[model samples]
Each structure stands twice: as structure tokens, then as C-alpha cells.
Target: MTANKGLVATAGTELDRLAELYGGALTYEAAVAGGIPIIRTINEGLAPDRIRRVSGILNGTSNYILTAIDQEGLSFDAALKEAQAKGFAEANPIKDVIGIDAAYKLIILTKLIFHRTLSLAQLAPTGIDHLSPRLFAAAKEWGLKIKLLASTWESRGQLNYQVAPVALNPSHPLYQVDGVTNAVVIDSDLVGTSTYLGPGAGGKATANSVLADLASLSRGEQLTGSSACLRIENGRPLTKQRYLVVNPTGLPTGLQFSDRHATSALTPALTPTDLQRLRATNPGLETLALGE
Candidate 1:
């Protein structure tokens, strides 16, 4: 409900206070990212046994910054200042920059998805502050873009949650989201994968989403499906196939690979670790996967 310096702490305390006063008939949702309305759907209707992964883009400020940097060639500082000037960022901007804003939203989302309460401390938070213009340039060269993504996945009783910038290949649906828009992709056992995309941080857009939810409630309908609460046994960890560009100068000695396709493409046998090492050493190397 509130996102001051200690946004997560404030949210936790407020939820507890309201739970006591309202006998757990409490719901909390906020327009933190662009105009996205992330509702805290915690109540008896929740079923802990049915959820698998909760993931989404939870910050409109970062999204806008990245979009501007990629599309308009704006420097990070310039983009951020532009966002602040346009009322997209707060004067302080630490919450959005440090990912505390997204972390708070994830905390609420995870609680609702898992049908259990989790403190903000349980989730690890990362941010896009470390991203440099070099990375953006590299992304452009690699035919990709960078975006800050926040997600939580549970498998075999282990939960992984992080907020960080990621390089999305041209094929990933997320790569297409430009400007201040936001999207959430939820994968579950019953329904497989479902994606919701729209504006993440506008007053009017947020009010529209809230009104839609209210209309559904008035009709005695649920925004989530009946299988929303279903649970599944944690399975294998999800792995993504990624692409990497490397400078031939920094490549380790004796790594044998020929220029099969335009000097940039390598054989598919290269491992992710190898690519990571190459990325670390190569100053201007870029990489991008073909598609999602």
C-alpha cells in the first residue's frame, strides 16, 4: 500500500495491522510499476498446493529507462532524468533504482501465488544500476535488448527469486515490450504458461485495472482460474538457451572453432559456462538468443 524508504517493511507491518483489524479479510494491491495493478489476492480462496512459478516485470521506471536507452540511444543517467522529469520516477529514485519497488511487488505476488506469507527478507533483490552503456551497446550489436526482470520460482521445496537486468533475445516476448509497459508471465502445472501485458504505471490505467477487478468481483467472478491454487511437485530447474558474442582477441588459447557462419556464429556445442567466461573477458562482446 505504501512504498517509502522501507517499502517492504512498511507493507508487512501494514498487512499485519489490517489483518488484525479486518479479521484477514484484507486485500492489498498497488500501482507501483508503470500502471500495472498487482493485487494482493491473499485469502481463504487461496490454495497453496497449486502454484509453481511467479514472474513479472514489476518496475515501470526501469522499463522506461531501458526502452529509452535501447530505442533512443539515451544514456542511463539521461533516461533516468527524463523519467523523473516526466513524473515516472520519484525525486529520490532509490526504490526504483535499487529494485526495492519490484521486490515489494514480488513479495506480495509470491505470497498470493504460494498461498503462504513470506517476508521481504526471504527474497533476494538485485537492480539495474550496474548496467552500463557498454552493455546496451553490446545488446544492440547482438540484436537484443536489456530489461530488468523480477521472478520467483519454486521447485522441490526450493524457491528462487531475483530482480536483475537480463539480455533478451529478439525472439523473447519480453523483448518486444517497449516504453513504460509491463508484463507478467505465470507458469503453472495446470495451465502451463500464461502472460499478462499492459501499462505498468499510470494513474488512469491503474484505476482502470482496479475497476475491472471490482467489476469481476461484483459478478462473483475470479480473475484467476479455478486451477490457480493447484500445486505441482517441483521438477527440473528451468534452463534457457542463450547466445554470446566474443572477441577473438580475448578468447582462451587453443579453443578450436572455425568461422562457420559470418565469423560470429559458433557451433551449438559450446556450453553456457564457456560463453559466460568469454563474456567476462571480452570488453565489447555482445550476445543474443534467437528467440524465446
Candidate 2:
């Protein structure tokens, strides 16, 4: 099971059952971040500690596009084209830019860390295609960088996930990660916080991860599986955060702008539900969550 296909980790895949019946190790080291052994690390190294959160820039293509747009002042389409030219992105990079790629990786992490499985439809990730040059300019002025972040955490004892482009301040660990690099920030009760950084793409890097898994099997080490009871709830978490709204044609009725301008504003703390409602009502509105 060296393949990185996301379907293997989805709900009802019965991956654990198949592995058990076959007496084989279920290794998916390259399934998440290309070169980051995140699955193994969480399964073994940090098993004792309770993981509080798993967050990262999991998709290299999306990260590269965002970095190019921010650093070189390239438009979204131009940055994506450049990424394709550099082999950082595919000719059809819809999954990467649309956040579905990261969502798949997040699904795997959620299962490994929290013993939970979620479908792609349940994740419903938000993409980076809507971002404009003005958003990048505003982020730079605010001393922040925008990254397509995939994050999952337990909020009030329930798991909450978000895969979207977020404006992160300088202090964040994943803030400086750029180009085709991947970074995973794991925060646990014992370790407090640990960041793993590496090349996210390229055949060599991905192959190395696959080889590592094969080597583990040769050493008679088998990947573990959990039989924990599954739990699920719909919709994005209700946790509130400030948002950067750009070039809004119409604002949601109750949504207040802290910046005092209609063209652009840093919105007051709002929840995902609020944003969804706003989007449903307001067309041509662009927004990015302000990372804490």
C-alpha cells in the first residue's frame, strides 16, 4: 500500500480491515506531505501525548502559487502558470488550488491523530483561486503572509477542520514557509509544538518516503491501526476570527467593518457560519481569515 491515493484513507475504505486480514503493514508515509513522515511521527513518536492540533501548508502547488503572487507581485493566474512551468504544479491543478488536495491529507491526519475518518464532502475545503493581488498587498502591509493552511483541532471536545488561504502573522511557525516547501506544525500537550519542514513535491522526495515505508516493512515493523469509535458532525466550526475582506460589492447586513471603508476592510471577529451566510448573500466578495 505504497500508493498515495486519498481514497485509501477515506471513510468506509476498510483499510485497517484489509491490512488485518492480509497480515501486511499499512504504510502511507507519502500520502500526506511528500517528504514529511507525518503519519509515522504521529502514530509512534507522539503517541503518548494528546495532540491538540495538526496544521500545515500541505499542498506544494498551492503554496508555490501563493508565494509567487505575494513575493513577485504576480497575478493568481500568472503565478499558477509559472508554477506549472517550473513543474511545481500540474497542467490541471484544480485539486491543489481548490484545497481538495490538502483536505485529503487532513483526512489522513485526523484518522492517525484522533482516530476519526471523514469524507471529502464533509471537509468541503475553500480554495485559493479567489485571492487577488490586492489581498497580497494588504497582507504585506499588515506584516503578514498568506498561505493555504490545512488545520484540524478539537474545539470544546469536538474536532474542527479548516482548509483555506489564511493571512498569517510573522510569529507563526508556518509563516516563513514558501515555494515548493511543506511544513507541518503539530501541537501536543507534552511537546507543546514541533514543526517539520521539507520538500513537498518532486519525484525523488516522494520516492524517498515510499522507500522509507518499504524499508520499515523489511525490518518487520508494521503500521498500527486504531479501532476507536467514529464520531462526526457537519459544517465548519463556530470558532470566530477576524477576516480580511477585499473589494466587496455588498456587505452582509450585520457584518461590521473595523477599517471604516467599503472598498476593503478588516472585519470584526466572525465565525465560519457567518462567512458562509455572507457569501450566500454577497456576490463578488473576497475574504481571507486572519490567522491568530
* Clash count of each predicted structure: 14, 0
Kindly report which residue pairs in candidate 2 clash with one another. none
Best TM-score goes to which candidate? 2
User: Residue-wise lDDT of candidate 1 within 1-292, one digit each (tens)?
Assistant: 2332244334654665675686443333444343444452222223333556766777888888888888899888999999999998889888787787887777666555654445555555667776656556656776777777777777556655666677776776677887778887767665567666778766677666566546555665433222233233222124544453444444333345453223344324345566666667656655433333
* Model 1 residue 258 lDDT score: 55
- Which RMSD values do the candidates have, in order? 5.5, 2.7
Compared with the true structure, what per-residue lDDT tens digits does model 2 show for residues 24-139?
76888888888888877887888778887889999999999888888898889999999999988898999999999999888888877767777788888998987777778778
lDDT, candidate 2, at 288 = 82
RMSD of candidate 2 to the true fold? 2.7
Clashes of 1: 14
